[model samples]
Target: MKMAKIGLLLDEQTANKKWAERENVFAFYMKEVLDHFGIPYQVISENTDPMEEMDLLIAGLLNESDQAVQQLISYIKNGGAVLHLSDSPKLARWAGCQVDCGGPGYGYPAKELGYQKPVRFLKTNHWYRAAPADWNAKEGFLTDGSPEGPVIGELWMTIMAGSGKMVHCQADLPYSIVGLQQGLEPIHRDGVPAPDGTAGIDDGLLKADDSFTMDWSCDRETTDTGMNYFSEAYADRWREVFYHKLAEMALEKGLTVPFIGRWPAGIDQIATISHDSDFNLEESAEVTLSLLKECGIHSTWCMIEPGYESGMYKKIKQEGHELAYHYNALEVENGVWSEMEFKRQLQDLKTKTGLKHFCTNKNHYTLFKGWGELFEWCEKEGIQLDQSRGPSKKGNIGFLFGTCLPYFPIAWHTEKNRKYDVIELGFLTQDLNHHALADTTVIEPFLEEVQRIGGVAHFLFHQLHLLEQPKVGEAFRKVVREARARKFEFWTSEQISRWERARRRIKIDRLAPSGEPELSGEAPTASPVIWVPVPKHANVLGEEAEIRFGHLCIKKIPVFKQAQTS
Candidate 1:
């Protein structure tokens, strides 16, 4: 197999300056990932003359620049495969291809906290249908003029046709460019370079075409990864069973699935504390953590602001519990605030309790307005992750929309600018949707999908809701135990965040300039030596010892028959 060379053409200046920076970073990182698979590539600035010998030509971060646009068309016409990222449909149409704009994109409202509508996949026969198969179509504004008619378009068009096969996307190029570079073929044909000083399509030769024809495409198979409930009574039970299966699958795949100790690895048990007056913080924290410890599990606690007793925040943290903000703006209904005010309140709360991450309550349904803006603010403030992009009532009910695991956020275009600061870590599943968990039988199938797609299984349970039902707790524990038996890893939100950070660092390192010194390594240390005091009456032959450490005390006895001892 001959090694292929790929070239990238990017506009260094434009409305996409930030995106350009990200693209550069990603290109470096991707080079490393591809190197692992034995692929070679290079990135060239837009100013360089077009090289006709490259296997693929990718255009990054382009806008409506007349000169740059003409160069791209010429590159494609000359038999060079092109991949376009973060551009408009007009570019695709100009290149002789079709583009679907999902529609007027909606932002979440702060009052809504997060989005809570189900996203459904509109059946399509596009080249990248595999994404929709693995992805759940949640609440989003589809581009206009599609068969679906104003639905949220999950796929963005970045590359369009000029003469050869071109791939386009609205998301960052680096994020989706790997697929194109690995697949498409460069086809050169004869054509006039649309006013650009570049080779026309008719002048170039085909250089091993096959950019989109690879057998290992990510979207090869399509299954319903949607979350829906069969019946109301079986919702909790279904969640338990689904979680158990998720752990089993993770173990099978050799991936650590982290969850509360009671559930399997990768299956998380989340308890929401909606009101401060409902439970005593100090007591509840101690009791909950103690119970979890007894069961060898750690759980996530969602806290509602202004609803808990004074000093409850400190108490919860002191107890070694996970804390997440639970927005209560929906409770007020008619309360409206500016984006600045909303961000100020969120920041103030973070300052008071030292809590940085949060998940909204039922208000996720209204995230398209205030909540979306807050997400942008979170990016500005350096918040690590957001878990608010779940399904609501307006979209498909009980569906998952993001990558099964954690991913960077797509850019959001405001009236003037675009922001891509925050990343989204999708919840595997939620209880309020009442879709997947409505029946116990659905557990096996639901979990199968989660494992197949490499997603986390999250179950949201309110303490009050479960207080009357101890069986629910037992069922949850059963799932956890099952997962542990399968060798899945349990994790807390903090742990997940840490892991994500580490992963990103690794990615960055791969993209860093070559010849950098290797990162440091650490060796395992010896286990602690335990000293036990012998009882005064104990003999050398056989003895018993009573040991004391801090508040713990234990008596040890030697069980031996009286042998021939001197």
Candidate 2:
């Protein structure tokens, strides 16, 4: 596929680098913006020759050399699209564009542009009629304004220019600058009339107008608008700009193009669920099993053994759901339970409920204190998996330290000289814990990480929380539906165990390790438990009300006599 070339000119000196690194500013926007457009772009020092033949040049705030400035002029003259973010107007003026100051007073430069004044579109007979009306206008000082400030004409700094053309504000357009043409076809941002029949906007000298008002009825108020919220309109504008830049670059280079990703083929994703209470498990298990049956999705559910409701264990087993123990040993606050007691309780629960495999509780954020001890116990007890690694606050210590993907726990000889069969299956970020640090927007990047590493994404959530809020439930359902639609196979914990066992056997056959005796028969076996409950509620023909669970319906016999006879 033909890829469009994009170059970023930024001044990454020591001081700026230090500041950017601390805040993760550049890294966050740079990768996201590039990925959004599917455009392959490279960042270069501000001093690099801008006149070099390229599809688009994004000059940062510090490219000030006369030669470098002239190079940008040449780039524009050669028909290359240029984006100057924050302080780039100085270079813009050198490129023959006239900048007129709009709005009142000098404003502070924020990371993303924040406008204070209402920007009214003059609506000249220009090409960009499709642009959104009434932008929140702010001031950009005129390129050649006198020390005092009134200018004849105002430059309404709106993103969309003429003929569906849009210039991204703050210079750094956040979207994939490549693949944009392929994705958003027919929309281009290059070579529209510059509002003035000239090559670029004129950099006329002007003075600021403190009392300019297009509408006298509207009060002029100044308030700080926070971060840009996600909107379809914004996304569209970004997509358009990205594609236009890419198309312009593609035309410059002779290359064959192909669309990204195979259509109709599913993209792989991981499905997971968290278990908090036994009632939570029972409800989730029933719903999940039914949903999976209907949609053919495999999902994992984390279980809290002691915390689970009575009779829930057998139900989970019958439904073929994976069971991982949720450990809250660290969160007791009083530190009442000892390491030995925790292990004993887990083993006892396993024996009583017939659950062989399990994972720790999400409450272990306090510390990973007893993880090593737990692993030792698992090795002795023949428990197979432990999906409890990752950040947590309830647990004072982290557990299953080494492995990222599922793997056998490193053998640590205890004082008692015992081995364990526990393998640590890592989790994706904890929903509550991580969300407390970032926001929902981070979910996409997290998914990308999982895809990149070919890892299973383990998500933990409280059923109560999900069910309590309709919006949250809908969002949760949407994420799951989207993931499934993308071709991710969901496996219950039991299913994962089965797959892992089969995978291990295949590996064993391939390796045939010395001193390790080959298994003479199929893997270990356990009887499946099934529970059948008597029907308590039923409908009868011509009956106005439903029959109750304890009450038997009979039209011919008196209730007292029938009970006595029985």
Candidate 3:
């Protein structure tokens, strides 16, 4: 196997040290992309790369010195691949497109990555627009001996320097993406004021069924990854753009890779029928439980603060239904309760229900407010899973991370410094929408798309929706029957949370540089449904592994054997 060395070049002026030290979204998500593709990489700085031992070097908006620019150009011309994201004013002569510094330096609205975005070596003509078009560089400008003129098209140019290739891509990707992910106003993407404090819930808004909707938005260009949910949304095409580019770079260095899907098992889609226990579940528990029983579904029931052990406890314990906790956001927002109160709440629930610990969680208002602090509480309080990363502010309902599968969040933790895996199951397509806005029309297409892509199709329903809007009982029944008809995996929230932890622990290893690496851990037990993705082109060396789309599904083996060749 050939080893490929990829280096990330950094500029001092723009490389924020704090962001680098704390939660560096760029580095975190970039590594996620690389690891998914089985590509290994390292960070390279100006002072670093002395011997120039890299096959490819990636850099941000190049605002460095003239000497620094020439050094990279020389490397590329000498047979190295250079991916210069956004503009590089210093490399105007070689790149064939110069940054239009005379044009607006900033104040441009951000747009999603488009298919027509021009590229050089990439086989696909499309791209993921992580950042907005802040740089105004005209592509394919015919350069005279010195003077620049006759700029043609959106300035994305490519040049051949001896045996090497250089591409002046006209979009600022990682830089702007980081800002957007952190709920910041993407002024560079859209000329807007800085992010006004955290998004505020609407005062007098409620769904037709009287269920709460978390529809939020910012004036600036926003993404589901952030808070703004109600505003005009932009499609996050990161998967397509990043995957294509990574494959392109690897092929340049001689490597093949496959796209990673969300769901693990052969299950194309996942559906969770969750009932939020805002009202006293012990008294009214039979109502929701009977509904699930009628639908042939064992749903997840989450409680606000279980005060006493009642019929609900016996049902959850004996009936195979899952138990979870819910925090009331209105109590906190209205200053009626503090976070510390949850500690007592957990104890009260355990005492009443005789359940030692709780694992999964949702919120009263489906609020992600103070989630970081809430996660810390979850850790100290023994909560393992959180299903709160939804993208609704107060009226409209949608996806947050836009996936159905569960994942450990990287908001505060890094790879080396670890804590418990805060499994975030992205909640998409809630039940409130069907009655509130007749969004049943909007759901079928999404479910079909999820099936096509082999993703999850999770839906949340408040007990109030069932108790108050008795008219929409058929709508809920139809969704469950359809899911059963499709054979989608029906797991309780607790089951999903436990399964995700087990999934993460089973590390799938592959070869270095060529997209697959090594696994270093073990799962408590091999599950028939437990599946881990391996490289599509991986050589399993006669190992008993199920290969689908290059993913070697780790079968249930009592003894964990290292795949010597895979």
Best by TM-score: 3
Write one digit per residue (lDDT tens) for candidate 1, span 1-566. Answer: 11234554544454346544432223332333222222234656655555465566555445456776677677767655654444434565474445443322221111111223221121221223323423223312233232234443443233334445554433332332222222111222222221222112122321111112211111122225432321111112112222222222222223212221122223332221121112324554444455566667665665544445538667666766666644334434433334564555556567767766453222222233322454565566555555554422211212223233444433322312232445554343333323323322234433444443334444444453234345444545554554555444555555555544433331111111221112211211211111122222334243222222111111211121222334
Quote the positional error of residue 267 for candidate 3 in Å.
Answer: 2.0
Off by over 4 Å in 1: 1-56, 60-81, 84-287, 307-315, 331-371, 380-382, 392-398, 415-419, 431-443, 482-487, 507-566
lDDT of 2 by residue, 67-180 (tens): 655655565655555544433445545423433323222111221222232222111111112333343334232211221333222122333222222232322332111111
* Model 1 TM-score, all chains together: 0.49
Whole-model Cα lDDT of every candidate shown, in order: 0.36, 0.36, 0.49
Minimal lDDT window, size 10, model 2: 205-214
Predicted candidate 3: what Cα RMSD to the true structure? 9.4
Best by lDDT: 3
lDDT of 3 by residue, 301-380 (tens): 77776432576578666877887777664644442234677676667777777789888777565544422556666878
| TM-score per model over all chains | 0.49, 0.37, 0.66
Candidate ranking under TM-score, highest first, comes to 3, 1, 2
